[model samples]
Target: MKFQTIFKTAALAGLALAGTSALAHVGPDGSAHHGFLTGFLHPITGLDHLAAMLAVGVWSAMTTRRLWLAPVSFALLLLAGALLAQAGVAFPAIEPMIAASLLVVGLLLAAQVKLPDAVGAVLVGMFALFHGAAHGQELGAGVTLAGMVLSTAVLHAAGIGLGLGLKRTSAWLPRLVGAMVALMGVNMGLGLLAG
Candidate 1:
């Protein structure tokens, strides 16, 4: 089989492995988790967060002339969100907005849409705020926020790597992943509604 074929198969298998429950974001039961280590692991463990972060990276790499703008925008805005949450500011429809982020980012990746740097930054920045707010509500310490941001950066880098590498193999691979992410977002939204 060709490399592209193999990658397609692998991506499909990954989708199956991802399962429906990956959308669930469980809090740290009993004792609240603190510091960098726990924060680092937070995004990695949650599929919704992981997918959104990576999709931003992949989309930025594929579409943006200024590669760093969108990801940096996302990170900085995420921190601002967390700070907002720590200050006891509440955002309306936080969960719904997070689901929307996945949908928007996934569609952007699938379409390989190219927006102006500032536009792309603003788009991802909006998503980052909700993500940060979610994290902020759970882990309030500065060190924990640092850890989450670090992990998010790593995931974004991995996404960029995936976008670049997959483009070499076949353009469809990233798009496939994007489509899957989008589907996941829809499923999550439905689940939220059902619950």
Candidate 2:
């Protein structure tokens, strides 16, 4: 098979895995739990979180030469942020930054602006810190932390895979995805501002 075909297949598989994993994980009765499944489902359940996470993938796929590296960096940084949060470090602007990530990533994807791989990776990584911190805040300390981190890593991989798959499609695909992301971002922004 051709490279494109391989990428498409991998992408599809990744998305399927993500969707399946998401469906399998359910939230605790009334509170957040720190566990593999909970960690994975946490981001998937939140529209704002999902939009921003997926936007990271879409923007990275469109703009960066090292597409895979962008998401990897995001995951790593997110894990670090989670650790920090677990350690009781406070970050005041995490929510705003998360919202901004969605907006900026959406705009980048919509505009089809290609950024240097290093710059794109760094930006995504920085955003991941905020995302990770949010995740960590909800999870109590213990074995659950590790499980949650692992689950988050899987979700991040799934998003990246979905983006890579879309990249192999028609040129307009990214633009369409970008528009959707931007709309989601706007919705999230409104909600955040309201709250």
Candidate 3:
């Protein structure tokens, strides 16, 4: 009987914590996003999206391609996904996908995996869709879209900068960062599931 109570208490506590970090969808109260500043700040406020975005940039910078393929692909596909969301298209398992993206990207960086440029682009593109859709679904106007796009680009650049800067240090630095990102992803994914 004591064990049962302990288990129940632990489970309840876990559920409560999970719910506290949820990235809830924009409700009617969020209709305040009237301009660029709001749009620019939106994605930054979401830890899940921010981590995933930064990982993409770091991975791309660390890639042999050393080109713009991954970031460009993310941008274009993100735009496409946003459009779909605006069109009222519903994607299944959106939150899970978003969380999984960070895990995948972080693991890739930690393992220092290399793939063809096109393939990498495709992988990041998939995540971009979910990320963009999260924002697009809540935004009924294009006024903020442009700002978000610009903000996304800036965030990507910052990640690239971080990756490049880390290159000057021991190889393990970026890998450590990747591991942390992956751990965060796991936390976010479990939270979403528990909630």
Candidate 4:
């Protein structure tokens, strides 16, 4: 099969599995208490959430080569993290890692530094794991979690799409994204430290 075909198939399969998994884990209330819209909006509702998702996209776009690999790596790793969290696995520094994602992603964008593509992809993948773990912890096992995960994936896609679209507009776009990410990092850090 062609590479493009394979990529599309994989993306669709991932989204479908995530949606089913999310719907399967509904709470004891017997209905989706959060509903679809709320679950869909969950990821983009907060600054931390928005920044992290967008950072994933920006970094993915910046790579310019092996672009799809970065987001795919993030999604797979994120699923692994979510599974770990659901299983009650212990991870010491999840919050700090999430905060660091924002800080690092933002710095990359602001400085317009072009990391080796592999390094950049790995960085985003690592951050995705932490972010996914947090979501799993909050949503638990259910349709809600699946829905939220799908929502997050879509949001990540949006960010990447935006970043790619904007890549030719100006040299400063990445830096601007980086600044926003940095601000979110600071906010996340405060929240993590305070709690």
lDDT values of the candidates? 0.81, 0.66, 0.74, 0.65
Write the residue-wise lDDT of candidate 3 on 120-181 in tens digits.
Answer: 99999998998788777766467688777777888889988888887776587577667666
Q: Give the TM-score of candidate 2.
A: 0.74
Ranking by lDDT: 1, 3, 2, 4
Displacement of residue 79 (Cα, Å) in model 3 is 1.9
Off by over 4 Å in 3: 1-32
Give per-model TM-scores: 0.88, 0.74, 0.83, 0.73
Model 4 pairs in collision: 22-143, 22-146, 23-143, 25-142, 25-143, 26-143, 106-178, 109-175, 110-175
**Per-residue lDDT of 52-157 in model 4, one digit per residue for the tens?**
6767776677654766666677777777776787787755677778778777877877776677777877878888787767665655455666666677778778
- In model 1, state the lDDT of residue 34: 88
lDDT of 4: 0.65
Best by TM-score: 1
Worst 10 contiguous positions by lDDT, candidate 4: 19-28
> If both were scored by lDDT, which would come out higher, candidate 1 or candidate 3?
1
| Each candidate: RMSD | 2.6, 7.2, 8.2, 11.5
Q: Identify the candidate with maximal lDDT.
A: 1
Ranking by TM-score: 1, 3, 2, 4
Clashes of each: 0, 0, 0, 9
What is the lDDT for 32 in model 1? Answer: 69
